[model samples]
Target: MHLDPFELHRPTSVDEAVRLAGELAGRFDFLAGGTDLLPNYKMHINLKPHLVALDRVSELAGHSLSRLGAMERLSRLEQDPAFVAAYPGLADALADLATPLVRASGTVGGNLLLETRCFFFNQSYFWRASLGFCLKADGDRCHVVPQKERCYATFSGDLAPPLLTLGATVEVAGPGGRRKVPLEKLYDTEGDGIRRLRLAPGELVVAVDLPDGAAGQRARYKKLRVRPSFDFPELGVAVAGRWNSAQVDELKVAVGGVETYPRRFDELTEALVGGPLSDAKVASLAEEITRRLRPVHNTFLAPDYRRRMIGIYVRRAILEAREGQGG
Candidate 1:
């Protein structure tokens, strides 16, 4: 498939980019890495009339130990010794994401805001047309769940789970002003896959900020996919916490690629914070996570299998984190 013609605007600064986006409104899409958006465009899914390319925006490319610019390349972060050492779980997720060539061009912001995928939504134009279209693109109803008011497309990103577990925040700029919100808040749990993100019109993600002490936490990311080489995650579980001599001091768990958004188990984490890291506790936590998540038949994997793997992966990730802590 080939890309349909559209005007591309290269904005030099964030202010200029926001202004252009505000003017273009519903007709434009922000181009950072184009690793995800360009392919979707080729499939004729959510095609925009204009494109605001952010490659020339110098401010969006900055990175440090604590703050990572949204436009920072995935491959750059994966290969950087200091970055990898500081955030091993994040580094692992990046390493497991797509192939090296795609990772070299995939941006952190793009991955965080990756589009929800489904068997019906991500298809060639003719293939979708034969099925009368789906809710995400040209049609009005959802084919996956056959719902008139909801879409069941799955969020297939790998970076979000680990970042959420790390308690990262994101800086966003728009016509109103700049503001920072917890990275988990970026997703709209109340909305369907067609309208998943909570970001307003013309808003751009500036940077992702990790708290000062986040790097010191013991963390692990476990992913399950059809192929180990370069496939989108079927199930991803990320766990992070500090251990106090075989006991949990602090804890956070986030799971992705199951539903409309990446979700964190606050209650489970709070309950386990002061408890001992025993096999029984880990098994209970895993069982609760499996009960809470409801993976549908949108991806290549079966719903029941994916749902079961969530518990297994979560259990394995927590144990791995515990082992890393030498507890």
Candidate 2:
């Protein structure tokens, strides 16, 4: 069936884009790679009257590395010098999204600001229609986990987990003014309306900043999905920490697919601070953090299984980050 008809606008600068978007507010949408947006558009999701494309704005495309020289080195004996020196955990996080072709076209801004997702929520209009809409899609009540007052759609993207661990910040330009905020603040715990991105009317994400400390910190992302590749995460964890001599000095963790927003396990973070990067402590911390997670049945897997896997993947991520610390 044909999707709804809409107007499209291409503005050359951030100011212009914001003005048009603000002027059109509820009627407009800011387009990135059309990666996730277009599909939802076709499904008659939000029903905006216009598509405000951000393609002409040149600022959102490139990426760069910051210097974090104080951190410990991960490996030595340099083999494939590029591979040996490269930040695979960081690079791989970006590379692992959808596919190379999609990556080439996909904007980092779009990926960071993706809408929350779930197995029951992301279907085509016809598919959703057949089952009746769940809380996230069309209907008021959640079909995936009945009696739930709100939606439990999982936020399942790869970039966010690592970015959050790396202490990435998002910059936005809008009618209100330009501002940058920690990516962590962009999300809230609850899932309805699902997006935690706090961009205002006419605002568009300009660039993402990876802090200098984040560049040097040892970080890794572990994603559990049904397929080996390309699928959204069933459970994902990103952990970044630095070792000061022999003790874990600082740690940042971000988890996806188990909640409405990518979440940080503060209790575990507090426990790791000033503690040794020992195997036992990390495992115990993971176990303790898993107990705090509240996974729901919106995903393909059972909630109990997803909840248990969060701890498993969390421990794996911690070990990977520790491994990168270079004993």
Candidate 3:
């Protein structure tokens, strides 16, 4: 196998890194853990040029929980509990990504910025060469199911699904300046070239601002894959908001490993609002969900099977959230 040649850049500071990234513009690729990028290079899937490693940028690594600890004061209020409760689900989601060894080296900024995946596309150049290139690779068509105009790669990151459910905002530093945007909009609908991530040239994701969920809001991350662990999701669901209350308030639903971005079925969520949370209601909502999702045959499982499981997982997620909320 032939390895692609690429230049590597390591800046000592975030400011320097951002500047370097800005100067390099679209020509450079950002390196985090190299778990995904290295394999792509080895497979000849990408001919990388000017790799800017973010490892030297200390600001992107390490996180603080002191803010959540500060919320302990709110426990004093008898009528309303403190916001410390919101951290558990977020912490749990972060803790659940990959294994401990990977976590030590992996950064939150990298995980959130990871590229979308497709079983048919994320292969060695040899594999794609044999099958011919799909839309995501060098090829012009989708191999999973031909006659498609765009790539059908699934966004396989586990953190993104749950983070969107929590209403997290991403902070990125670029040449123009620093800005924050809803993490949900970071992905684009067009899957052929990379999904719509608003990452500007010379921009680096710094930290993500996660809005604390309400005291009653409960969230869960459920992923379906061939293996029980270590494998990327074939279908992932993240459900958040106050499902435990008698009246449903704001709800956030995001699904991954099935589409270009984490998909939020707002139309379906609206159908369930103000209705009793029941098995019957769940069943009815499942139909709406099925209508909204269009999964392709790109993962380990069949597209039809994946589509069917979408409803199953959505129903199960709601039930689980309700149970957690004491509904």
Q: lDDT (0-100) at residue 127 of candidate 2?
A: 84
User: Residue 295's C-alpha lDDT in candidate 1?
Assistant: 91
Best by TM-score: 1
**lDDT tens per residue, model 1, 209-264:** 99988886788888899998999999998888898888889889999999999999
Q: After superposition, how far is residue 127 of candidate 1 from its true place, in Å?
A: 0.4
Candidate 2 Cα deviation (angstroms), residue 282: 0.8
lDDT by residue for model 3 (173-280), tens: 888888878877777765454444766667777777756543346776677878754677888887886743556666667788787777777767776677567788
Rank list by lDDT: 1, 2, 3
- The residue pairs that clash in candidate 3, if any, are 21-202, 22-202, 133-139, 188-196
Instruction: Estimate the TM-score of every prediction.
Output: 0.98, 0.87, 0.84
Q: Could you tell me the lDDT of residue 148 within candidate 3?
A: 56
Evaluate all candidate structures by whole-model CA lDDT and list the values in order.
0.90, 0.70, 0.67
Candidate 2 residue pairs in clash (backbone atoms < 3 Å):
none
